[model samples]
Target chain A: MARALAISAIVAVFLAAPFAAPSYYVGLLTKMLIYALFAMSLDLMIGYAGLASLGHAAFFGLGGYTMALLLMRAHASAWIAFPAGLVAATLGGAVFALLALRARGSYFLMITLALAQVVWGIAFGWRTLTGGDDGLPGIKRPVFLISFADQTPFYYLVATLVGLSALAMWAVTRSPYGLALRGIRDSETRMRAMGFNVWRHQFAAMAISAFFAGLAGCLFVYNNRFVSPDALHVVTSAEGLIMVIAGGAGTLFGPALGAGVIIFLEDFISSHTQRWLLVLGVIYVATTLFAPRGIVGLWTDFSTRKRKP
Target chain B: MAISTTLRRTLRAGLAAMVCAGLPLAGAGAQTKTPIKIGFIVPTTGGFAPSGEECVTGAKMYLESIHYEVAGRKIELIVEDSQGKPDVGLTKAQKLVERDGAQMIMGIVSSAVALAINDYARDKKVPFIITCDAGANELTMPGPLANPYLVRTSQNGRTPSAAAADFMVKKGWKNIAVLASDYAGGFDTIGGFADALCRLGGKVTQEQYPPLNTTDFGPYATNLDRKADAVAMFLPGGGGLRFIKQFVELGLKDKLPVMDIYAQSVYEPFLPQLGDSAIGIYSTLHYASPIKSPMNDAFVKAYFARVKHQPSDNAPDGWVGAKAFGDAAAAVGGNVENAPKFIEALKAVKFDSPKGPIALDKYGQVIQSMYVRQTEKAGDGYVNSVVATYPNIDQFWPLTFEQYESYKYRYAELKGSLTDCAKVLEKK
Candidate 1:
């Protein structure tokens, strides 16, 4: 009851953020929520499923491009187009996973990287469809969601969507299927001997992970009102990986908090000094050296130490 | 009673948001007495950082000369880096508009960034003056994306190409070879030039788009048409340097007259490295240092004295934008609150820019002279000396609005392919 009350209070604050905070902060927070959702989805694969796919951005980019083509090209409405985008991203994930699951460990990482490059190549080389290097600009949200024109209403919509996605992820990770995936991560051979369909679970996790990532991508396109090949680049995938690692992989809500840290750090540091890249590097190095388990790990460690004393 | 309480709470939340927003809303509500703030967005930390640095320096030099005051209102310039990405550029633009309270936006070096924010700027009713970025034509051309609030002071992809084609026609060069980087800008530029050349009864014997950043133009050089009078090309960044060096090493510079629209690449910062290899090369641009005019002389003198290095074409682009802003501010009597009136003043704004007599078309694009220059030996190094001039050239040169509209509609479905040459040649 106490936990539920606390969660409701947090939701209330987020709900009122758009109306109570400055407009730019609302914009910044909207970006933070989308990135946090992306990071959490990545954590599902790398942390729980023990699958470190470097080309995760392929799904993200796929979602964005699908949304763009449907709305801009086909002139489809949001309700139909948004779901179609998710379906496209899920199929893309399954297809890439088929090629990726052909190998394991380091080979799996390389295959994922190669597959991502293939997607990037298609996005870059296919000029007629993706607009090549010129990129597709001027994406608009549905007229029903005209609050996107104003910062406040858009922030509320983003917060609600992100909250639901996060809740879904939390529920999935706490389920029995999630436990079996964790068991596979610990010892796949043992889990298989115990009659667990390890490959099926991993594949299912991959599809689910991609669905959430793609949803985040849809929100991203709407937020920025543009789409480009940069969405599909390896740098984007790497950013997700970094967020997962820095946020404390395998911990629910940790990656989300981690996303907030990195985004706010970049925004604040860049505003004060142009050499924000160097500052980010320093913080990353410090995090790796001291907080190996991440910010959540540090908090749990502190709480346990206090209890022991 | 519960609904009324909920409404009151909602009103309070909205009030809080507004109060928080109002804290940083300083420069936004500028009256005649308040200082007008202009937000400058450019790539200061990316591949285009050097170009951004040069543009900022030029703008600063101009601002310092004028003492940064126009019409009794102190002009505050807030600089933000777009990082050459559309997403980053839009975010920075939002920050500038919402937080910095800038009335006008200036200095976009990337076309994607400029186009990405076009709708938002129009919606917000902010007057955006594009300082430097070329390639995309849909920005000013009549289209769904084009907005009246956006004005481009920089060259479009086809402006220089049209001027260059006219220069070639005047020179009586019947056959020309074309080369460009394999990208959108390259295709757009070469296509414009080729079409214009064909329309003028000239022949383009060969055309090639090498993969971007191709270091070895050896195979391409060997395939050059020996019968062609000149080679018209568009190569970007260090690719131009490598191509020119390789062309010189292959002993092709002595044989064929090479020309391009972006003459700044072979001039100034790159000229000394290129040495005499760049000599006699012809190119057309909106501005060149050798142009003989009072405003040009003063700008060049001031820029050279301050920076100690000769200004590239980009310096004049920044200077021209700054001049327009100052003139518009003066016309409005330092009051930027009336956005429609300020936009009208900007449309009527014209001055003797360093690039020569400059004015705006109905579409708010810079209409100015285009200079065809040859790299000739100056006091020490080489300078692009004016060989020919096309005066009062608008964005769509040689084609009237009706003609251009008809042509654009006709070719709207046509991809700018190498096949365009054969089609135009057959028609000729």
Candidate 2:
């Protein structure tokens, strides 16, 4: 009952944020939601499947660039461009999975990084199509059933989409397939011995993660109406990793919360001081030292201890 | 449990820290009269930090000169660091306008950042003045990308390069080996040189575009056309510095006379570091510290007093941008809130800048003199000593606007292809 109430309160806060906050803050919130979805998608691999991928931004970038190019260059409707973006990301993810799943642990990490770098190189080097480092700008928001030209309407669209995605992800995490993924995470050899195709499960998880990340990327491009090689950079992939790790890698809500905290802190701290990167570095160090399992881990530990007492 | 308590305490401490930091800013904002806010964005971090710092110092120095007041109203300047990323720049632009309520926005060091925020400033109808760097030609050109709300108070990418091409052709360096960093600004600047050179009956012997921030200049240095008259380069910042050092090391400096298109490699700040290697290197730009003028002397004096060093190329650009803003605001009777009137006033602004007499053309691009500078040792250090001056130069110089715009190709489209430039120039 208490859990239900807490969830409802969180939903209420997100729904009411646009009305309460300024347009700038609302824009930031929209970014936060998109990042949360991105982080959550990453969490599926890192938490449930025990696959540490460093080149996740490749999928994100592919999705964003696809949507941006289609909308800006071809002037395609959002309905066609949006789904095409997901298909592109999914294909990229499937291809990466084929290459990356051949190895395990650190080798897997290296391959993913290399593959993402290739994507980044393309985005950076192909000046004619991608606009090189200057990037492709001037993408207008789609006007479908209702014109989401305004901030409020756009915010509502992002919120509704993000909310639905989060629910679907939650349901995925609780399913038997999630249990099998956890079993593999615990011991992949044991899962293989039990006649389960471990590689197939991992590949599916990766593809699914890429799909959600693509959705987030499409939302992000719309949010800014701009796309650059920065979206495909290793820094972006690293940021997603940090969000997942800092929020609690194993849970859906943890990464979402982590994304919100990091995004807000960065914007807030950067506004206040020029030494914001230093402060952020110190926070990361503290997080690593004190709460090894993340914020969610700390909360769970505290709540259980309180109940016991 | 111990960790959880520690986490709780950390959360509390962070909140306290935020409150402490917020107090002074909150107090500063509680003024009786609402000041005319001008938002300035520059890369205070990342690779472009030095350029960004110079721009900020120059802008602040100008504001200091006016006592932060124009036409009886106080001008409150809000500065944000873009970190040299396009997306970050857009976010900061949004924050400055939507949150901070800045009447006008100015200052950007990267062309990418400028282009990123150009649409935003246009859509919102906010006056954006490009203070330092950010020399994309499309920002001011008569095309689909032309923005009414935007005006560059600095040089276009083509200006200095075009002047360099003219200067080079005059010096009989007809066959040039062109080398530039592979990026938007690089292509635009070097392409301008190629186009102008071709128009003047010169030829590009060979062309090489090394990627931006390339550390290893070994391959590029060795691959240069030995038979060419001179090597024309547009490498900027550290990459430019590294390339020159490597060129000198490889003994190629003696063999090939190097001419910098934008003076990025041989600028005031980089000269001291390059030392004797920088001597006799010719370059072209809008500003040099050693230019003799009363206004320049005053600017150098005040700038030295503030920053304790000679101002670089970007400082004057920032100063001119600020001066333009101040003049426009004053002309509008300090009512910068009157957008249309203020924009009109901005276009009509003309003043003797530290560089030279500056004015805006009909397209809101700066019309000023381009200086041909040669790095020479001055006293104990080095300086970009003025060699020659090309006065009253506009973005489209030599050719009339109609003639220039009649070409099917822009500088970007003509990248690494001097033949294409020649093809376009040959038409009509």
Q: Which candidate is the best by DockQ?
A: 2
* Superposition error at B155 for model 1 (Å): 1.4
Question: Which ranges in model 1 have alpha carbons more than 4 Å from their true place?
Answer: A1-6, A143-149, B1-22, B26-30, B264-267, B305-308, B408-428
Structural similarity of chain A in candidate 2, as TM-score: 0.98
Decoy 2 TM-score against native:
0.96
Tens-digit per-residue lDDT, B325-406, candidate 2: 9999989888787777888899999999899999998889999999999998889988888889999888888777888877
Candidate 1, residues A1-309: lDDT per residue as tens digits? 998998999898898886666678788889989999999999999999999989889888889889988998888988877888789889988998887886888899899889988988887777767777667887777456464556677777778889999999989999999999899999999999999988899999999999999988888888888888778889889988888888899996888988877876666666556677887898788777767777677667766876998
RMSD of each: 5.8, 2.6
Pairs clashing in candidate 2? none
Task: Kindly list the per-residue Cα lDDT of model 1 for residues B1-428, writing each as its tens digit.
Answer: 24334534744674465466559674346357677888888888877877776777777777877899998888888888777878778888888888778888889888778877787788889998887764477788888778888888877888888788888878878688888877667777777787788778786788887878787888888888988988888887667777888888888887788887777347577888888888888988888898998888888898888778778878888878888888888898877767788878887888888888879888888898888999888888788899888898888888876566655322212334433555643421
Q: Which candidate ranks first by lDDT, i.e. highest? A: 2
- Model 1 lDDT at residue B91: 84
